[model samples]
Target chain A: MTDAPPPAPPGRHDRPLAPAGGAQAVSELPVVTTYPLAFTGQAGEYFRIWIVNTALSIVTLGLYLPWARVRQRQYFYGHTWLDGQNFEYTASPVALLRGYLIVGAFFLAYSVTANFDSTLWIAGLIAVLFFGLYPWLVMKSLRFVAASTTYRGLRFRHHGKAGGAYLAYGLANVAAGLTGGLALPWAWFMQRRYQVQNAAYGNAHATFRGDVGDFYVIGLTGLAVGIGGGVLLALPLIALFFLLGGANFPEAGGETFTPGLVAGLVGAYLALLALYAVAWQYVRAATLRSVLNRVEVGGVVRTGATFSPWRLVWIGVSNALVQALTLGLATPWAAVRRARYVVQGVQVRAIASLDDFAADAAPSESALGEAATELLDINLGF
Target chain B: MTLPAPDPLSLSGVFFDGRTSRDRAATLTVSAGEAQLRVDGGLETRWAVTQLRIDPPVPGVRRVLKFPDGSRFETADDASVTALEARTGRNRALGQVRRLETRWWTALGALALTLALAWGFVAYGIPALARGAAKATPRSVLATFDRETVQFLEDGGYLGSSRLSAARQAQLQTEFRRVTAWAGGGYPYRLLLRDGAPEDAPFQLGANAFALPNGTVVMTDQLVALARSDRELLGVLAHETGHVTHRHGLAGVYQGLGLTLLSVAVTGDLISAGTFAAAVPAALLRNGYSRAAETQADEGAGRYLMGTYGTTRPLRDILARLDREDRNADESSVRGGSRTEDLLQTHPGTAQRLRHLRDIEARGR
Candidate 1:
């Protein structure tokens, strides 16, 4: 069909349940079939869309932003396939436009008031108000995104409560602060649990069996790798700096730019960049694998991901370098490559047929929460 | 809406009833302003063709026809759907957008237009807006901002009591008052001498003078020590006076705010906006803005120096000496300090400033 599908590993999907087709019999063994997620978006195609969107946004003075965002998301979701059916994004742009206008007005007022000394208190008041309502907004955003996304004609739902969100975020912050950020992994674990456990596909609520200890392990390991690698890389660069006569350069009242100094600085910068990329990608890959492997939806489908931390780190660092060298013109290609890698890593193991999942009554959600959260750069990913 | 009766087109696809994930092999036929779906098992459904909600075309992606009551029929037969849409006349504008998106030439044109518009906005639009906003800011607010900034510097240990003799300090303060008076004294100018060489501070202000909003000028003790004569010190005060009179401090703040907002908006997402890729251009643009401000301040100082001393040699000499000191510091520091000076300098080079001052002197003569 559409570009030969990656061959599913034999033993992974070959574990057939008892030949009895009854629901009870299937539930006993649980594992029936594995469906690998696929992303079929092309970089050239997406590049055209990005260019058109940018032009139209500039032409319309950003009034077309909501429409552009919806279109972009639709493209991404529509190309992501699992079990021969693609996902869908069905949020109305008009609804999003309303939210955009409100957020825009709030942003403008806040920025303007914040610039002047006399009006700063008003800005502070607005900040306090925003902070107080952040949990509610996050809850609403989760509900909105879930309701807007559909797969196989069934919408995902979010059942997270505002009070629960407040408790999760508040306690995490307090704990992290009290421990001088040593409890950051615990905070991240809590946040991930809150996000995952409240999500559902159709009527099947998700459950996260991931352990908090795994988060600490990943975090500590990432820290150690980052520091150790940075030092290891720095040692040679330091030697190079001395070898290049950086120390012998004029100590006072002379030209600052020497070939040795430039070379040393550049080398150090690149080394630091490499270390950061490796550490960041290591944590990301490990956390993603841990979470995905432990998540079960409806107790019938178990989801898992396989990503080699080093391989992912390589991809991330190279992607950054490509984007930087291209002055952002390679953004579409980079995005597609990353998406393909991530999607290919995910597998869904289902005990029952995909057709059995039923739709939940869609909850009506205002787009304001999504707009507000996106503007504030808050991550509410499930 | 009325449409001519067109030949019925039959398309085979999978249909979902919206209540569950169950799919049916079905055939869809559109004719006489009505769409009918017949499943292989003989289940039939009908809806007015005008009631159909068709998703805009994405190339190589399946076209989905959303029916009333949340049912949907998805098919890869895009040509058939385009013919059906042509007969129905819906989503015309979105179809055009899709057309534009699929064309190579249009995309190239869009890229060019975006680059031009972005360049124009950064080069001209933002500075104009910042200028207007800075002018609109109230003097009282500026004064409060200056007071808070000075307090912050003191609390952060970046500023300390000057070590200069009381006689020297008074003499310099008198010279600063005279310089401001010579420059028409448009602002309530005040001078503060501070020690800026705290090893623990995040930034060292060696031999530097800065003007805050509200006409407060801070001169470091090192700058005083470096000055060869009171006339050289007076020339430096004249330059700081120019910064105060032109409201460059507030303008610079507003410009920074504008640049941040513009970058966030242009990148269309916070993630890319935060990336190093987007930051470089913003940094370059900010440098351009500050360099322009510095040139303007230099020109203003040159005019005042020419009027009072009949020559800009004093100001030019002090600038050259400061530049030399900066280079010396950079050379001594093994860190390759101010590495971005070539691309991200916030001030015009000392040589350039001297040439401009020389031009002003010739014009005065």
Candidate 2:
């Protein structure tokens, strides 16, 4: 005899609710956002945390750099607010570590194989081979991370498919290349779109860009040279030593000097330094202006612009020199500069009025201290 | 007669699920005698529409009509057709409602399978292969490739190679140990130095070096002499050792095997065992990997330099120098016999590698 059919499993069989995709916008249920449906807490707050971490990184002369990025991303996302509430961040350290290890392992193997093999053509062929699938792999990895996020009364969603901001950014990059850097501002805009597209706060989209005053009138490279050169010039003894050579030694008779060599060195150094200063000014101006461009926000769109790289580059160079001279001490200035750069760029498209809306005592106030939809989960156990 | 105004259109019918869709129009031909609808949609398709039945508001006279595009419309003028014709769509293939005929269970199962394969290779394949090479190969046959390749062989060729003598192998082991100690107290490391015939001048034609499983690194004399400078030598060695510490060699074969299989699955083109056999020897004649892999290796190499030497700039210098050599030789014909084909290799561009190393260094410790 045929066995009777088993009953549908509980909860598993219940149909998942379709996305809130009807033409008519649905009014969300009234639940004070103890957590915003976001991966970060607040726009300004995200910047602050990133800045602090980035600063520390700069002090280390890039040694602590990766960690700084990780920390900034983690903190901003972990404590994000969702619809006035905090969303849960769920990325595990282990997952990130595993990814690093596996990818690292592959990287090494390829090196050896390539080293032993003489057919150099295979290198390009293989990269081309993987190029076709890179988008798919990125999509998979991104989606996995996204699916792991949660927000106020809604799970976070990822649109890491063959569409949207990625395409725009790609086009902008091509434009930038074609325009010989003239299209940087437009490219910067595309980058803003890419960043904010993933940001969500109670279904309200948020975005950002470099501030109007943030860009450097000079190019980023130019600005770097200017600040770096100016700082170097300020230290007479240091400048003289570098101008002569990094080898600073006690002088015989209060000042031992070689006229021709010293004069020639000084002349060449000043010439190069002067050129660098001029270029730095332009680059610095351009970079700041580029970052100061506005951040745009809308439903399904949220991101920010930042001009901090020029500051970062200048800080790093100065700090690197300081380390070179002092044997790695007194690097806080560099770190601070680095931190500020990243912080300025870290935007959170949260519910625009979140902090203001959280005027009354509410659970979401706890969320203000957190980020949205990333790794940290407020009340995750529940 | 002016074609009776086409009847008002309605998207009332259920649509079919299709996989292969194209944004194009097509013609359909049907024959009653054959009782078949021939859809000339310029694409092969399969479709499905289950339980297609229509109940009319009222019974009506049936009608048949024809259109000028050489088409016909057959239906009751007063009644609607409750027909489910596998949901017709032009230039679209209806994905057969499938029970996920997937080896995704197979693909998801791949990780475990790969781990198993990796273990097998470690436990059996590597030793067997090593033994085979050592047995069939002569230790005295040091320079494996033609002498013309020496300049390009970065490091010189293998030392005398009837097969590495037990004594020489022991000595090689000692040197590897020293380099290993330099890298760190104890990291995953191995050294495989294929000592070449000293006859291969300047750059050993048989030169090559790579890290193997669990810290095994192989280097040929060709690689050593090929480095025009001491720093370049150090850079090359450090880069290889970097692979050793990272266990790149082992991971690579594992990954390559997976990718090659995937490539074959997607494109039914198969490389014969003979092709691989030929390819291996030919590939061994040069030092290169797929561009993506090379980039990864460069990064790994850079990291190793950064971590071990606490400086990575030298690597950038070395790569740039080598790339210059490669590029200049071809352009100036300074070297008579350099292979033009090698320039078109799939390995990451030399400039790109140098840039990668620089970027890595800039990323900091």
Candidate 3:
């Protein structure tokens, strides 16, 4: 169980589905039921919503931004279903608008100060201030997002302490800095663990049992592949150029495949891209499997994810290329596809009955923190 | 005794009491203009149809209705929602959104229009607005930026101490002034000379001459050395002066800022970290001015060369040499890493710039 599992071969067990309601097993027997999460969003459907939102937002000079955000969130959440019920996003746009305004005002004041006096000191001061506020903001954002996300009339909740958030974010930052950024994997794991342990679905608190070693494995592999593969990819291009007699050949070089500088350069670019894409895929797949499977809700419901790194990488590279080529018009389709792929890979195992569990919706959190984080360009919850 | 079929259209759904998470089967009865809910025959609630609060339905999802007392009803059944909508009237905004989603052709048209409008704004509207904003800004305000940037460069070791002797500096200054004398004393032009960019270091903004918004031009020692004649150096200075006189530097900054804000406004996607990440490269690659702006600058350089040297030949010659120098130095091996490494040069390619200069000379009397 310590080693990461191999790619799940396609079979009845490969893609998990929820157990049939009528099925029964003996009381003494151990039961492992897999519940498949579903994303039913369609690109064509989302495009209409996006186009209208974009048009209206521009028409109103960005005043419709909050509403647009809410609509988009609602669409995505509403389509994500587990056990015949969907999640709901129930935030008030007016609150988010207020948060944006406050954040805007703060930036305005800072800009004025920066313009009139020494910018370096003022910028440093603002950075320090934001760093101090980071933990609090992350905590608030988590609570707000969790409280607003409803499933079957009950909102998910976060019970994590502010101290924990500070430990996760603040301490991680210091540690990463101290290690000259080499402690990134450890820091990432700690932050993720903190977030996961504090999550609650209905009445059950979540727990994370993942180790930092897994993160390092993925990180080291990514780094190794990035460097080794880059060199290997470049070697062929260089050799080809020398063989082709385009430029002066190396002292010991023998033959050239294609003797043109243009060919060699283009080939080199494509090879490098391939290496990067593959490296990123491996890291992403390994990380997702390690992180998600370790998160257990209510000590009964656990998640499982198994994705083919090569396939995931292919999707990512092609999706980016298509979006760029289309000048972002295909963004809706690409986003939906990516979400669908990730969601489809997830399987939830519940050892106990999930239908009877319940938790009351928490009171709405303040919008000020959420808005301020946005205007500060801090990506907290996405 | 069918009893009018129990209205036949009563809405059935799931009900929550707001105090508890237990879900119960619910039926919504609209009778006598009141919306009544009977839950598992255990709890009953009613509100006037007009007074009931309804959360707009997302397509293919549950519609939630809330009573003033905090209890709520939700159901994914389309028929039930339709019945409720028919009784209380549909939410106009959601209705429009739904219609747009279903009307494929209309959505397609809107998307096309949006893209067209965005392109138009980026290509034409932003530049025009930036020109206006630049003109409106005071020179003193722009000068503050100039001082700060130059100070920052000096502090960072990017601007090394000037290595030219006083006589050589004075000679070059005289030549610059003599070439631009036709502009008279009204143009607030100043010149500064600095060492070449550092070698074997990260920051490699090399062998460059550029203008600040405040009518100040910087020429590097490398650029001076690259010039075979004083006429060539003066030609470069005249070009930098054109940038200052036209306020292109300030306009460029304004255009970049304006486009970023406009992109956010149009997309309404502030939370997408990719939005900002993508913006950085766009700004870097868009550093070059439009063809028209570059042509204007080149013409300005040609005009100066003609006035001072009696021909634009020196400017043309220097441009060709610079083109050759660039070709020799274009050995940077892009490892296909960050997009910033491949950012388009802020000036036109040397060939294009030379062609434009030749065009200017051909048209010059």
B-chain TM-scores per prediction: 0.84, 0.41, 0.76
- Compose the digit string of candidate 3's lDDT tens values, residues B13-120: 778766555667899877656787899967887788787887875655567888887778876565566556655566767666666655678777777777777777
Error of 2 at B42 (Å): 64
Model 1 complex DockQ against the native: 0.37
Question: DockQ of each model against the real complex?
Answer: 0.37, 0.01, 0.27
Ranking by lDDT: 1, 3, 2
Residue runs of model 3 more than 4 Å from their true location after superposition: A1-34, A101-117, A180-185, A211-281, A303-314, A368-382, B1-9, B77-90, B148-187, B193-209, B219-238, B259-291, B299-345, B348-365
* Residue pair clashes in candidate 1: none
How do all models score by TM-score?
0.84, 0.32, 0.78
Local distance difference test, per candidate?
A: 0.81, 0.40, 0.71
Per-residue lDDT tens digits of candidate 2, residues A10-102?
Answer: 111122245477556475633221111222123333333333333343344334433443444443443333232223343443345444444
- Local accuracy of candidate 1 as per-residue lDDT tens digits, B203-285: 88888899897889999999988877777777888888878777888888888777777777766654556666577788888
Residue-wise C-alpha lDDT for candidate 3, range A127-170, written one tens digit per residue: 67877988888888777778778876777988778899898889
Candidate 2, residue A52: the lDDT equals 39
Clashes of 3: 4
Clashes of each: 0, 150, 4
